[model samples]
Target: MLLKQMTAAALAAALSLFLSGSVTAAAEEHYDVYHYDCWSEAVPSQAGYTAERAVSGQDLGVGNFSEPTDIFRDSHDRFYIVDSGNDRIVVTDAELETVEKVFDTFTMPDGSETALNSPQGVYVAPETELLYIADYDNSRVLISDYDGNVQREITKPDSELFSQELTFLPQKVLADKAGNVYIVLGNITTGAAMFSSDGVFQGYYGANTVQTTPEVIVNHFRKLLSTDEMRSRQARTVPSGITNFDLDDEGFIYTCSQSTSQTQDTVKKLNAAGANLFSSLGVTWGDIRSYYDTNTNTNYQPMICDIEISDDKSINCLDLTTGRVFQYDKEGSLLFIFGSKSDQLGGFTEVTALESCGESIYVVDKRKNTVTVFAETDFGSLVHKATELYNAGYYEEALAPWYQVLQYDGNYVRAYEGIASGLLVKGDYEGSMRYAKLADSNSRYNKAFEGYRQEWLSAHFTQVAIVVILVAAVLTGLHFYRKKHIAKTETAERSEQP
Candidate 1:
């Protein structure tokens, strides 16, 4: 009895560590791919930063591996990677010492072998201990326990849906505390498919407002389906279909279904109750993400192939199509972006995945069949640290950090801004002006913000300062005058009355 209880406690502790996201991607070093069995003669350099190879072979004990689609760390510090090519979810011990197969029993749909079909994204939600997946090709969202047991499938209905094809070719899947899962697509939303944690389909929200024509992607919302219109159709076609999507965490569902009078990219942030609290551009149509290099201070335009939100809330965008990584802030502001055009060690040429584990960052180069790790110390030597220094009001100290990253990447953007801004703050107007002009000269269009920052400061600092002073003065005058008047009025009224 004592032995059995001890074993159970140990198992529970391990599981907890595997589910925590903070420690999930922990690693001291990284792997650089030298070979892969999937694609012949593939080189890690071809994948750029997306190609951070994982541990080779089944050496870590997870048993023979297959084409790993996505890698995630659980709270127990165990690594769970979906080996889609092998039709299995692989796991690694807390120490990453032994790789083992945790879930050998995944539910195969009515007539399938094994379980998953072209599974894309794999995420283990600690709040619910549920593993959510974008079961691509199946047109469904498959749910499972952390051990890879398929518990349920979430799919949209057909008969009453707007699109002739109610296909859910889910590309990415994410889950929040409310048991709501977010699914991105290889195509557009038929309606943002909603489901409870138990796999009960709540209903669909957000129409497929996106229409891909032979011409440019339609930015017009009126041409697409709207929520109100869906209501009218739902009552006729199907009683449960919806048109408005309110993502609790993302804030609002910027459905591009409104009339054309105002339709850029419908950006809306919604609350848990589905109330639209904020609305702005969510994602753009036909928009490809680009990365501006802080080193060369040049911008590289690439098709956004993959994107992930880091633990720090920074959006890690990858243009594996062009071999680049674009980092954007939560506010949609572009920060320093970096990637290699070279096929060399320490530098990437292609990317399969870009993951940020709390202590370090990892990039998987599928072509090379290896993972390259970047420690925080390694990151501290990069332009990002300098940007941090600049952001923390330590402008002068940021110069060295930014300069080091420039040695490796010449096109990084924030580095230029750091140098330029730091100079401005230090009262080096000439240096600041030089950097601003140089920044503008590089892209031939002032794509860098250093010039803009300097110009804006030079343009409005005095006006803003004067406004603050005037407002302060007026408030002070009003306070004093009101007090004096009240006192005098009381004296006059008393004397007259008496």
Candidate 2:
């Protein structure tokens, strides 16, 4: 009996250990959290954000979301989910815990009732408190109030600038601070359709420039040599249209386009004048490396489908092909990368849009009909605190937090860069240079090296000056000695000859 009891206890302990190990392994396998180092190599990293929970329509007391396409959080802290399949908009509270209202029908100004048909996008103007819905199948954008009263309807522009044969299938809509409306249309490569506040067509805005590739260069030469008929028979290459966009507090619009072949202009920060501000940075917006799929036996490149600018100015870009979220600082430096394509809790299927609220990120999955909420981890908070200070020019103040970040993540390249910046500002040039080298920041290292060189020269200036003076005096003495000796020898030779 004693032996039997001991065996049972051992069995129970083994089972417990096995179960715990399985749980830990499962959690780790959910996502591969990593960041690209200065060498463009993938380095393992601590998760900046984790999947806290997933909220569905049923969780919010509304029915299940049917193929939701977009999510927008207004200034009032309410979420407007565009349920495209249901042809309705579901409004929820900040936490997505309670349903506020469901907008299906709206009363027109002339007292006519109309309903949405396959709406794809929705945005709320904070200042005007108006709702902008991109009614896709209806081929129009509707501006309505919270009470479902239509204020205006913007349809396709009848102008030479816009192709008359193409349908105006609005996919996403946003309004600038000046009340100028921009709509992303289906199958239109020109750009987003822009309209004035009063509903007048203002032409397209923020068009992407075509990438110059070797093939394109060859094609250009071929077109030049070919006849007009032959050139017309060839297919015309055009820039990919904008997939989605978000406006920042400063009125800058961030747009993302889904393209696997084109790298340039995949993501753009456009100014009011329609110039890409991020063009000069030359930063890669999504995953730096391609991923191989065993099922398809093919490599998949990053397809950036959506982009969101957090309140703190962190740019969050969503990759459709891999279902990863790449978060970058305001200067386009990548901070963290997480998420994947799976059916697990943290995984996503057909991710369409994302919105950030405070420290949480809400990602909408169309195929799953659910929204996954990711909360910032402690490490993420530390990084953000350090980044905020660093970006604001408080390098010295950010040093401590950056150090703490290194304690958590020794491989964090950004933390090294931050520490180098702080040390540079504090006149620790040598120390700054060391950290800059670790961060792989050549620019920062150059600056630190220059500072160090100047400091060294300044400190040993007197010694160097004395040595230079001594060398000059010795050369002068040698010159006079040689001249005098040569003259004396010549005089002796002449006297001897006489």
Candidate 3:
């Protein structure tokens, strides 16, 4: 019995050691290097964006944040954190280390005061130094200055166009270069509510388009055949509401709709006339496939919560589902995807907003009540430089940076495309075709093939013409020889018969 007990103890100890070794190996293999392929499938690649550090209220000496909703970086590089639950806006310096200013209440010109109530969005005009706040619970917008002096208070419109039965609960606000205010109302499917510089109610702008399917066509036909009473009972077709939007330096508005059902026009770049400038461009906004989580055994579809436009025309979109920030170029090519849904420093819970300040990106997590800062990696820098030149129509000049990107991440489809485009512009059609094929870019490959065919035909034109002429001459000589031989044979046969 004693000998058997000793052997069993030894076996148990060996099994324990093996289990610990397996756990250590799993930990070592885990890495945060997620990327999207040509088909928008999330795959592992070199790290593009990493969470450098996280800044909470503790880091900034603000005690603790409670439900921080939005983050914005203005032209002066100032950081604004909308502390909604605290009913105040926290301002930090360019480094985000020291507190610059805090606004809790607004003093009106009439010697009255108004305090913020669960403010959700904040925007500061660069030229005029004006601040716009979307006071959510109050159902109004407050136009103020840096010192919290109220310039005007814009409430719900009393217009014939607006439905009186509905409520105006503004969620996000922004100002254009001309001082026009655009406010996004909750549950408003028509578009963003636009206002004039003087606080007059303007019409809506940049409404989302309704996606049409076969069912929608059938419904429309049925509606046409139904009576007015039946038509009233039928379900009305409406567009998905716009979730968030950002303004570029060029006065263009970039908008995103977070509806999973409405896949078309999920992201759009609108011109002044509310025309989608990127409609003709073949690009999808977010991940093309549903993200599957092994731990939860569930599939998640990304809902874009906010959008931030960088000075170099990079589109940074915040995903609420997986806490990932998907960065795209001006032409809608995915540059890098970073962040995750974890309790770790780089991960997030309830990501609400995003702001881009120069080389860094700040994301606000409402549930965690913290702001996570992400700095660009070396791979990210190379990709951004290549994208800048490529978007500017300098394909040949972008070749070096794109090649450097490939050195870091050979599987980067965009880099392959960039190199292909550069080769095409340099008149190296065959070389361009090879890169285009590698990138799986059919349109680019077709262009390269057409150029190659044209060049080959031009080069061998003389040889082809000589061959055609010689062939034609030989055929004519053969025809005449056969005719002459037949005539002689016929004459000889006739003479012999006589």
Candidate 4:
């Protein structure tokens, strides 16, 4: 009984907290989470690509990479690569050298030792340092630690609850700040999967409506094709070999719908409430080229084969064919483009993954089996960008750059406050309140927000009328109860006198 009482009390306290809207790690209503793409930069050059000691490139001697497909970083800043062709994962220091066997042997869920056929995605939870692998061949997401300790296979959502469709050959697996892993089943036709931090299957999203290259195109290309033509045709379905699946610290998932010759490709974003946000902003590599092509321009031919987000919330897409990396905003605004077709250890060739850790950027090139590091001092400029947008009255636009500022340096309290101001300028009171709390952290905006919120409530609802009616009813109930009790007591006394 005592334990039950304590549990109830605790639950009540939680309910009160929710009602008061004090804490927000969890929310009473739907949480609004948005995702921004970071900038993409080229891997440093090697062949005649000498750095000023400030720059570092990948160095693989003899036993290096066969087909380095993916790269991931653990909490300890250790790098892991899916050396697909070699059927192993390579571990190295911050510099992509000194290859060590992080996981010597890995297998399918059925204990079949057939090797990880094209392991594509690897994710490491910073908290637990547990690594999750999307084993494409085994059709399972293998869970383990950074030290190669095998955990368990993530199962499918129970078939009884939802009718199973197709078996997913997982591709890219990404983790948000909360440690939930989202996987892209290789066959876009099979859709994608989601799992909890502990490897428990959550649910699946999307459908097989993915656009793939038509059978006719593949058949036609099979008949008349040189080596180059064959490669290009094969990539028609997945133009960029890079994983489009990525995350912001917030719980939004950014996955490209399908890469093709279509006028536009959908970038399916699932919000915090599992709402599918449909947009076609950054998925149009072909369209971007057509703009140049239609104008009889040759300079705009896109050779991008990879994409990654920088710390600044802009996309960096590497043109493998051109050896260039382009950064674009959410609305497809080209911020900048760097690099040209260069085949060198430091320059990008067969480049794979790009990740941002504060002011530094990491680009892993599988051909070199190496990771290159670039330190950018211009992150402060990212703050200036947000400030410029805010000043220009583009409050919504400022929100993203402000977020980037905080991501690059959490100590930038001014950026947090700017986010609050931007939200206010956007006329999103609730959103303004959310960031304002974080900006102040001492409930400094409590009075202002409460006053605004109450004013909003009065205008938005029949709250005042409801309160008046409720108060009147409560008073009436108390008066009737007291009168009834006295009458009963008087009746009892009269009966005794008789």
For residues 1-498, could you state the per-residue lDDT of candidate 2 as single tens digits? 999999999999999999999855533536778888778899888888888889998888878999999999999899999999999999999988999999999999999999999999999999999999999999999999999999999998988888899888999999999999999998898789999999999899988877898878888899999999998999797877888899999999999999866888789999879999999998988888788889999989889999999999999999999899999999999988888999998799899999999999999999999999988888889999999999999999999999999998899989999999999999999999999999989999999999999999999999999999999999999999999999999999999996
| TM-score for each predicted model, relative to the true structure | 0.53, 0.89, 0.86, 0.51
Candidate 4, residues 1-498, lDDT tens digits: the string is 999999999999999988767533222112111122222222221111111121222354435567677777665667777777666677767665565554646544565543456677787876677677877777777777654546667645564533478566677787677767777765444345667777767766543243345664675576466576666655343332223566645556655433333233334455775554545344444224322344755544444444555445655565444444545544444443343334543366666666655445566666655555644434535754875586566877888888877765554554666777776766666777877776664453564476578768879678778888999999999999999999999999999997
Alpha-carbon shift of residue 446 in model 2 (angstroms):
2.7
How does residue 80 of candidate 2 score in lDDT? 97
How does model 2 fare in lDDT? 0.92
- Model 1: residue 121 alpha-carbon error in angstroms: 2.1
What is the lDDT for 135 in model 2? 98
Off by over 4 Å in 4: 1-62, 97-101, 106-117, 155-168, 176-180, 196-203, 206-243, 263-269, 273-287, 291-307, 318-323, 329-333, 344-349, 366-498
Question: TM-score rank, highest first?
Answer: 2, 3, 1, 4
**lDDT score, candidate 1:** 0.53
Q: Which TM-score value belongs to model 4? A: 0.51
Residue 391 Cα positional deviation in candidate 3, in Å, after optimal superposition: 1.8
Point out the higher-scoring one by TM-score: 2 or 3. Answer: 2
Query: Which candidate do you rate higher for TM-score, 1 or 3?
Result: 3
lDDT of 4 at 40: 25
Q: Rank by lDDT, highest first.
A: 2, 3, 4, 1
Which stretches of model 2 miss by more than 4 angstroms?
Answer: 1-29, 292-297, 469-498
Q: Which one wins by lDDT: 1 or 4?
A: 4
lDDT of 3: 0.87
Question: Which one is best on TM-score?
Answer: 2
